[model samples]
Target chain A: MATATVILLDGLAYGMVLFIISVGLTVTMGLMRVVNLAHGGFAMAGGYLAAMMIRAGVPFFAAAALATLAAGILGGIAEMTVFRPLYRKGELAQVLMTFGLTFVFIAALTWLFGTDVKILPIPSYLAGPVDLGFRTYPTYRLFLIVVGLLLFLLVWFVIEGSLYGARLRAAVDNPRMARAVGIDVNRLFTITFVIGCALAGFGGVIGAEMLQLDPFYALRYLVLFLVVVAVGGLGSFKGSFVAAITLGVVETAGKFLFTDIAAFLLFALVFVLLLWRPNGLLPPKSVA
Target chain B: MNPAWHALPWLLAIAFYFTAGGYLSLGTSILVYILLTLSLDLALGYAGIITLGHAAFFGFGAYGAALFAIHVNADPLLGLVVATAVTAVFAVVTGMLILHTQGVTLLMLTLAIAVLLAEAANRAYKVTGGDDGLQFTMGPVLGLFRFDLWGQTAYLYTLVILFVWFVIAWKVVHSPFGRSLDGIRQSQARMRAIGTPVWWRLIAIYAISAAMAGSAGALSAQTTRFVGLNTLGLLVSGIAVVMLVLGGTRRLYGAFLGAAVYVVVQDFAAKVNPFYWMFVIGGLLMATVLFLEGGLMEVLDIGRRWLRRLLRGSDPT
Candidate 1:
């Protein structure tokens, strides 16, 4: 029972971090049809920025927020210069270009802040365990779970409820039609891209405690983020949330049960799941 | 094809034999990449399958050859054959599962398969030697030439294999089967409408490409007498793609050209500043996508055309 509880708590926290990091990729891939392999580069940048700020004595929360904003701004710049030109290219071109961008980011980060791994300093208040009614749990993990749920709700409300959400959906479904209806699709793409990148940065800073912050961080966890997006079905917010949590739990359980073949077991699970649903667990309603 | 073009690879090989006396190993490495990129061209350029996990086959072949040489016979030819067979089987099994999905899903599946294999190799250190990799000396080529320290025999052996594979690839790309692949690439639905077995064709091409990549991997292991985890790494797969795109896709000879250019440039840059070589590669890749549409082949073709025109004008013919 104790093992199960610990696994559940740890899995939830891990899943929440995965969701926060991968959600941005899902949105961009769905809307832009661009395989932005460099999405993790933004996360890496945010992580380093947050780590540096925290080391400089700023509060963790404030540093994270500032780092996210910085990431958003950097995303805006990249979208205008690099990504805008690639919107019309084929998937192959997009893959190559974004891949190159990832290399550049990795090299630049290595040059800026040596190759050593940098850990995010968690505040003392959020470090220790908190007493739950049934059991005691780490405060930081509980905080992560709560934050993840809150972000999910906020994102869900904004994407599924608001008028802006409708416009974004319209633009994603048919950019020409959306433009014909005066929806300003180009502007919509810009805003959506920024938001997606910002989310990645925010996730990077917060999830750094679990995922680790380093120069190779971008490429190391790229496949995991991609797995979440692929299994969740590109462009589906709820799908990503569910997939992330499921993967996290499965990964945690696999590690506990089978130490050596945990990665193999996780991949096998994903493979079986993918075989069953080639399009993903929950495909979008309107196919592109 | 022009006679000059037919003799190009051989002429280049001979030229390198004399000029690459010091960098013979680098030359051999380039030949290996040519084989790998050629296999990629078969899949991505002709079959239009967007795969990022090709290194899986390469790594499998390398490990298979290394294990075979260590446990069974040390003959290079036998090792290559065994490696190719192993990778072909692996490709067929995985291709059936992955080729069903197209676009991003296919890419994800391919990457997943490779990563799984890499992780498995990493964990099964008892067999694979973990991250440290497996090392084993290979017997002489054709049971006549002995393995040497200067890599002279290895270079010649690799050159012969590369030439043979080039002929096979060239023949495959020009045959009716190759034309069918082009049709499938242009429009899978159209190919299916025309009663072509699109899935079987893809499976066949993928297996064939895997075999070729496996041969390259086997050759690497035989020559270097070492097989590391990086053999199956994502970076290897990505570099293959970059090399293929750098030369030009769909054109068989582009593989050689791209591999040559990429290897030479990388070697030079690494020697100059290993730390920033990635930046150079990244810049080149981005520039290729943004500016060079048809790759280095197209530029060379333009230059050749211009030179011919200039010669004709001067000759008054």
Candidate 2:
């Protein structure tokens, strides 16, 4: 029972990180239909920047904020340039182009940081254990859960409860109609893309302890992000949340109970879940 | 192409053997990669099955062939046949599972299957030799020619097999069934409306492609006498796609050009600096998508047209 509780908490924290990173990809592929395979590269960029700042004696929160802002600026520049041309191309072209972009990011990071895994140490406030009523749990994980839940709430409200979000949804549902209504769908998408990449950057800053930062960070964890988005039904935020948590728990449990086949079982779950859901657990209303 | 054109590549291969003597093993690898890329074209270029899991079939074939050599038989031909059969069976099962989904869902399914197989191969260290890799000695080809250090026999044997497969691929690509596959790729709904068995055709072509990839994998194992976990890695799959795109899809000859350039360039670049190759490959991929849509073959076509115009200098019309 004790072990199960510990696994559940760890899994939740891991899932929260996945959700944050994958939500960006969900926006790009699901809402925008661009199939940007380099989304993880942005996350890696943020994490790497934050790592450098912290190593140079910047405070943890300040480092994360600067990294996120820089990542957003980078996204904005990418949008106005290379990615702008790709919005009109086919998925295959997008895939190949973004794959090239990813390779470039990996190569760049390797040159800058060397091939070794880079560490991002959490601040003392969030480090060590905290006493719960029943048992002691890591303060860092509790912070992750709090941050994930808060972000989910904020994102849900912005996307579902605000006029801007309604316009964003309108653009996604039918770009022509949105354009006809003078929505400036292109601008809306650019904003969303920038915000999504920034969130991915923030996720990287906080989740570095779990996912680990390396030159190959983008490629190594790409499938996980894609799986979460696919299982969540692409454009659906709520489904991403649920699917991320479920997969995280399943992966964590597999590691705890069947260490020898942990990765195999995780992949097997992906296969079966996808077979069962196809479009995912909760496809967006337009798709449904 | 004219009947005489069939022997051009073979002639080059032979000439290369005498000229580049010590580099015959590298030449052998180029041939093996060409066959693998050719097989990918059948499913991806011809059938339009968007996937990144082709390496699963190739790696499984290597494992299958290596285990066959270790336990049951040491004859290279028999191992190749066994490996092909095993991989084809595996493809049939996975194709059924993954082909039902479309687009992103489909892509993820294929990736999942590949990762699952790789993980299984990793854990079964006793059988696959895991990270240390599976190594074995291959018997003489057809029980007559002995395996040599200079790779003289390996190059010729691989060239012969590649030629046979290339001919078979040519027939398949030009056949009526191949025409139907073109239809499906262009308009799946139209093909379905016209009563074409879309799903079955996909599975069949996937199996055939898997068989070819398996044979290539088996050949690689036999020639190199080793099968490492990296054989099943995403890098191998990605590199295969890179080669296919570099040459141009739907043209079988493209595989030959792409694989040769990729292998030779990688060999040279790695010697200079390992990371330098990534920049070159990545830049090439971007250039191919952005400006060179039809790849190197398209450039060659344009060059030939220019040459024709140059020959008819006086004809303004």
Candidate 3:
């Protein structure tokens, strides 16, 4: 019972982090039909940025904010430079181009950082564990859960309850019709790309401690995050949240229970899910 | 012009293979990629399958053949058979699932499948020799020819396999079935409307492509004497696609020429400056996407055309 509770909490925390990392990829793929393989590069850029700032003696929160904003800007640039041109190409070209971008980003990053693993220092305020009758869990982990939930709700509000989201939805549902109706799709693509990268950036800063920084860290984690998107079904933010959490639980439990099994069983699970439902567990109704 | 004059390209490739000093291994690598790329070209460029993870089959071929050689002590030829069988089975299983979707969903499914295979290879350290990769101790070609340390037998063997596949691919591309595939690539719905079983054609093409990829994998393992997780990684898949695109995807011989160019560039560039090789490749890719559009083969064709025009300028009106 005690282990179950611990697993549940850890699973939720891990899931939230996965959701944050993958939500951007979901949006870009869904809205733009661009398989941005470099989506994880944005996360890496954000994490590295925050780490650089923190190392320079800036406050942690301020460093994280700056990093997130920079990631958003970088995302906007990527939108303008890369994806816009690719929007007209076939799926293979887009996949290859984005995958090429990932290679460039990774090679450049490794050249710059020298392949040393950087550890983010957990703030002093959140170092200790909070008492919970059966077991004490780290406060920082709980904080991550809270932040993830808040972001989830925030994205939900923006996507579901806002006029901007309505316009984006209309564009996704029928780009030609939306253009006929006077909605600017090009601008929406840029905005959606930026927002998606911002989410990934946030995940980078917050989850840096969890995902210890390494040269190919983005590449290593990319498949996992993509699995979340795949399992959840692309284009549905809510589906991503649910899928991410489910994958987190399954992966975490697999780590604990089947130490002898290959680590990729979790990925195999996603592969099976994809086979079962090619569009994912909850495919988006709209296609821009 | 005599019809036999059109065979000039094959004659040239054979001459290059025989006499292109210090290019035997590089030529062989190109042949391997030509086979791999042509296999992919059949499915993706011709059939419009959009398989983003085709390297999985290639890796499966390498690993399966390597394992068969190591454990079953099978002949290299038999190992190729086993590899194809395994890859075909895997393709049928994954293709059935992946082919259900259209567009981006298909792309993601392919990526996911490849990543899963790579991850499995990574995690199964003992089985796959882990990051160190799987090394092979092989006998020879068909139990007759020995694998020379200098890669002589490997080169000739790879060339023969490549030529055979190329001829097969060539014949198929010009056949009725091949035209049907092109029709499907243009519009699947229309093909179905015209009484073609679009799905079955796709499965058949995917199976054939898997067999080709597996053949390359077997040949690569036989020649290179090693197979690693990198075989299934995104890098391999991405590079294959890059090579295909660089060659002129829609053209039959484009993949071959593209593979040759890509391998040569990698070899010479890394020798020139290892530190800047990636940057150069990235820049080349960016340039290719932006300007050439038709790939390196197209560039060569244009240059050849210009050269002929220049030579004829004063002689002809």
Candidate 4:
């Protein structure tokens, strides 16, 4: 029971990080209809930026905030310069271009910050174990869980409750029709893209401790983020959240229980899940 | 297609032996890439199946052949056969499961399968030697030529295999089955309307392509006498795609042209600065997608047309 509890907490923390990172991708993929394989590049940029700031004796929180903003600006520039031109092109072009962009980012990062893994200097307060009534848990993990929940609620409120989200939804549903209705889809896309990138950057800053900041971080964890987005059903925020947590727990538990065949079991589980639901776990209602 | 095009690969192969005999290993590496990219063309170019994890089959074949040689027999030909068979089975099973999906979902599925295999290989270090990879000596080629350090025999052996497989691919693509695949690529709905067994055809071609890729992997393992986990890496899959795209897809010769250009450029750039060759590759990919629509083949075709018009004294349009 004790082991299970520990596993559950660790899995939740891991899943929360995944959710924070992947939710941005899910939104952008849905809104833009572009694969954006370079999404992880933005996260890497944020992580690296935060690492640099913290090394310069800045507080972690302030550094993270600045990194998020910088990542968003970079994302905006990319969307305008690189991605905008390819929106009219096919998905293949988008994929190829983004993939190339990923390489460029990876190479650039490697040149700047050598290949060694960069660990974020966690604050002393967050480094120690905190005593819960029944069990002692790492403070940083608890912090991650809290942040993930707050971000989830914030995203849910923005997407489901706000007027801006309504417009975003309208644009997603029918870009042509939304434009005809004077929704300014291009502006809407730009806004959503920036927000998505900012969220990814924020996730990177927070999850840096957990996921490790490295030059290869973008490519290494790309598949996990993609899996969450794909399995969650594109454009569905709730679906992404649920899928991320579920995959996180399952993967963590599988690794813990089956040391030898953990990967095999995880993939088999994904295959089964995908086979059972080809469209994804929670496909949009309009499709049916 | 021009008759000269059919003779291009052969001419190039012969030219390399006489002119660049010192770089036989590089030549052999290019040939392996050609086979791999050609297999990719069979799926992506012909069948219009966008896969990002083709290295799964390639790595499987490499490991299978290496393990077979270490445990059972070292005969390169028989190992190639066994490797091809193993990958064919893997492809059939995976293809059946993954072919039902389309677009990004299919791409993710393929990537996942490859990653899964790579992780499995990493964990099964007892058999695979883990990250260090499996190193084993290969026996003589067809009981005739011995594997050498200069890679002369390896080059010729790879060239022959590549030539043979190229012919098979050429025949397959030109056949009615091949035309149906083109039809599917163009419009799956139209093919289905016309009574084509689209799913079955995709599965069949995927398996065939997997077998071809397996042979390429087996060839690499045999020639290099080393098989590493990177064989199944995303980088390999990505490079194969880049090569296919650069050479131009659908055209069989494009695989050769693309592999040659990419490998040669990579060799040169890596020699210059091993750490930053990715910049060159990435820049090239961007230029290809943005400026060159149909890749180098199309550019060459355009140049040929211009030359013909100039020779005829006709005003170029």
Best by DockQ: 2
Task: In model 1, state the lDDT of residue B192.
Answer: 95
Interface alpha-carbon RMSD, every candidate: 1.1, 0.9, 2.5, 1.5
Worst 10 residues of 2 chain B by lDDT: B1-10
Model 4 stretches astray by more than 4 angstroms? A286-288, B314-317
Positional deviation of B196 in candidate 2, in angstroms?
Answer: 0.4
Instruction: Report the C-alpha lDDT of model 3 over B1-317, residue by residue, as the tens digit.
Output: 33554576568767876787766777777788888988888888888888778889999999998999999975777888888889989888778767857876676678878877887788788899988998878877888999876667877888888788878887887889889999999899999999999898888888888888888888888788899888888777777888888788878678877787788888887797553556556666766776677888788778878877888996756
Query: TM-score of predicted model 4?
Result: 0.96
Query: For model 2, what is the error of residue A10's alpha carbon versus the real structure, in angstroms, after optimal superposition?
Result: 0.4
**Candidates arranged by lDDT, highest first:** 1, 2, 4, 3
Give the C-alpha lDDT of model 4. 0.88
Better of 2 and 3 by TM-score: 2
Evaluate every candidate with DockQ and list the scores: 0.72, 0.80, 0.47, 0.64
True contacts kept of 3: 0.41
Instruction: Considering only chain B, report the TM-score of model 4.
Output: 0.96
Candidates' lDDT values, in order?
0.89, 0.88, 0.81, 0.88
Q: How do the residues B208-278 of candidate 1 rate in per-residue lDDT, one tens digit apiece? A: 99999999998898899999999999998999999999899988878888899999888887787665777
Write model 3 residue lDDT over A1-288, tens digit each, in one string.
Answer: 888888788888888989998989988877777777788889999999888889999888998889889999999998888878888877766766676677677678777877788777778999899998777999999999999999999988988999998988788778999999899988887888898898898899899878777657767788777777767777778888989988888877877777645356676777678767776787778531
Clashes of 3: 0
Deviating ranges (above 4 Å) for candidate 3: B1-23, B119-133, B271-275
TM-score of each: 0.97, 0.97, 0.93, 0.96
Q: lDDT of model 2 at residue B205?
A: 88
Candidate 4 lDDT, tens digit per residue, A177-267?
8899889898888888898898899889999977888988888888888888888887778878998999888888987898677767777
